[model samples]
Target: MQSKDLLQLAEQFGSPLYVYDAEKIKSQYNRLTKAFSKVEKLRINYAMKALSNVAILELLRDMGSGLDTVSIQEVLLGLHAGYSPEKIFYTPNGVSLEEIEEVNAMGVQINIDNLSILEQFGAKHPNVPVCIRINPHVMAGGNTNISVGHIDSKFGISIHQLPHLVRIVENTKMNIVGIHMHTGSDILDIEVFLYAAEILFDAARNFKNLEFLDFGSGFKVPYKKDDIETDIEELGKKLSKRFNAFCTEYGKELTLIFEPGKFLVSEAGQFLVKVNVIKQTTSTVFAGIDSGFNHLIRPMLYGSQHHIENISNPKGKERFYSVVGYICETDTFANNRRIPEIKEGDILSFRNAGAYCYSMASNYNSRYKPAEVLWLEGQGHLIRAHETFEDLIKNQISLPLPAKV
Candidate 1:
């Protein structure tokens, strides 16, 4: 989005807000679909945990993207966004059997990760079709916290345990309709992805009743100016060719599924915060914004880098300033980063803030979370309202007598 548009949003809805460009989301979705258009059937099941605003969900739905959920609440959110039950897939890890049953009752696709849940769910619902999540154990991701499919990770069923999985399905007469595997997020090596896909394909050979193959998404997006990202075009070309060969060998037309989160909306979002103070210390200068980890915690929690721009003074002289938050802790966004000089009251926009930003925010320090706005076709629509003081007390009960305080 342009600086003027962001400034207008800051003025209209106030600062410390999340603004998403809907056009960018649409374009990203199109890029994937167009690349894999040659496949018989391709589905983009967006990981809703990344950014689960109802408006964004609806936008993705309108763009013909399926829903990938990790919890029952996300399944409900997708349903609320007008997605059909068949279009949703619940892929939970280390969850209870009761939760799996609840999701199964919703009539959406159920992907069982662990072997225990798989055995129990299949025994109870033998006739029901299910999907299996496999851990390729490739260990390919940018960060350890984001990586989930290594040998020690507790994400998917181990490839060596295929015998147990086969036994359970055979004994229960459960229909294994699909196969899945996810290495991790922010995957930079395309060869590693190809290797992971080979493992998924090998596992698919065990299930003759399969109709679809889900390669759980971890496609990377550029975080910095020269940082590397997944080459989707090249990946689509290579993986698609191999996938078609597998389909021919299996003698059935199968659907290809991906649960991409970051690749879809990371670049479409901007988190705007107003500079509250400019502290000049003997050692360093600080550009303190009126926000904290309570609003965007990716940098503090995951060491994620977000490109910050002083939108209010885009052309100002450059300087090194540590951008810090107003929270009562060592909450730093970037330390001694060189950017355009920031002044008091200047508005700064944090790029690549779409995925895992607002969805992971908290109301810590008794601070209210900011509002969310969507920029669709050159217009800004208020998707969420900023929290008020009453929100903190919404769930608290008032006591008649406070024990003689």
Candidate 2:
């Protein structure tokens, strides 16, 4: 999809909208599958936490990809999107044992991330097959906020505690079928990932009934032009060799799985926000957009950079402008950024907006969330409609003025 396509989507759906290129998603999926085509069995579980719209989910489902869910609701979404229970895996973190039991009852694959819940679930359901999420203590990913497999990150079971995990499994005779690790999102270092995979392989040694080893994906995607990206070809060549060697050592060729969120969809999204006003302050020129942090918070929340292009005037003279939002508080998407000259009502498209942008949006400042569109097979389809005032009060309860107290 080009800038013109995004501009057309904005014009049809209005600004402060999310437009996803379905073709990009298919190409990415094909890329990963083709890269690792030599493996005996490779599974790509599309992480639903990144982009959970039903249309996107359905699009992925049609691609023959599995679902990697982090919550019960996401599992339901996957199911609602036409994925079978066997194709969905739940890997929630910091959740209660009761929740785990509830999800397990749904017959989906269970991935336990903590020791307490692992032991609890093992004790309760010894016959059930489960996956353990091991923390490799590998420092990787783009930012601290996203990195999960570090020594200090509270995401997976630390590798040092493997003995306890083994004992718990042995004591309960629980079926340990998989070993998993997620070093975090926005991972650029390929060696660090291989190092983490080694840890996962070591952990799989104790599980005699293992079926797969999930090396959770955080393959970095380029945000701006000339930016570095994860070398998937190199990674596939190295990791596949090691994985095949491990399978040989383990006496069986188990499935290789990955739960990739951003890597699959980050490049497929474009966020379009309308320019509300062009203010000329004393020190800088501010291009205030009609949206705010509520719509896209990565810039302020994680210092993530989104390539902003003034599609309205792509060839116009360039100028440095501070792009601000209309939210009541201070929300700056970009400060002192060089872009083509912007005018009032010009639509600005934020590239690489597919992953966590809309999933993390909010209704803060009493504003509505933007609509979402999916462009599939050269056709535009409205995935979600723009929020309405009635939607804001859909769940609200009206009290009779507290009985005139």
User: Roughly what TM-score does model 1 have, to 2 decimal places?
Assistant: 0.98
| Candidate 1 lDDT for residue 335 | 94
Query: Candidate 1 — number of clashing residue pairs?
Result: 0
**Model 1, C-alpha of 219: deviation from truth (Å):** 0.8
lDDT of 1: 0.93
**What are the runs in model 2 whose C-alpha is more than 4 Å off?**
402-405
Q: What is the C-alpha lDDT of each candidate?
A: 0.93, 0.92
> What would you estimate as the lDDT of candidate 2?
0.92
Q: Give the lDDT of residue 52 in candidate 1.
A: 99
Best by lDDT: 1
Tell me the tens digit of each residue's lDDT in model 1 across 270-308.
999999999999999999999999999999988999999
Name the regions of candidate 1 deviating beyond 4 angstroms.
400-405
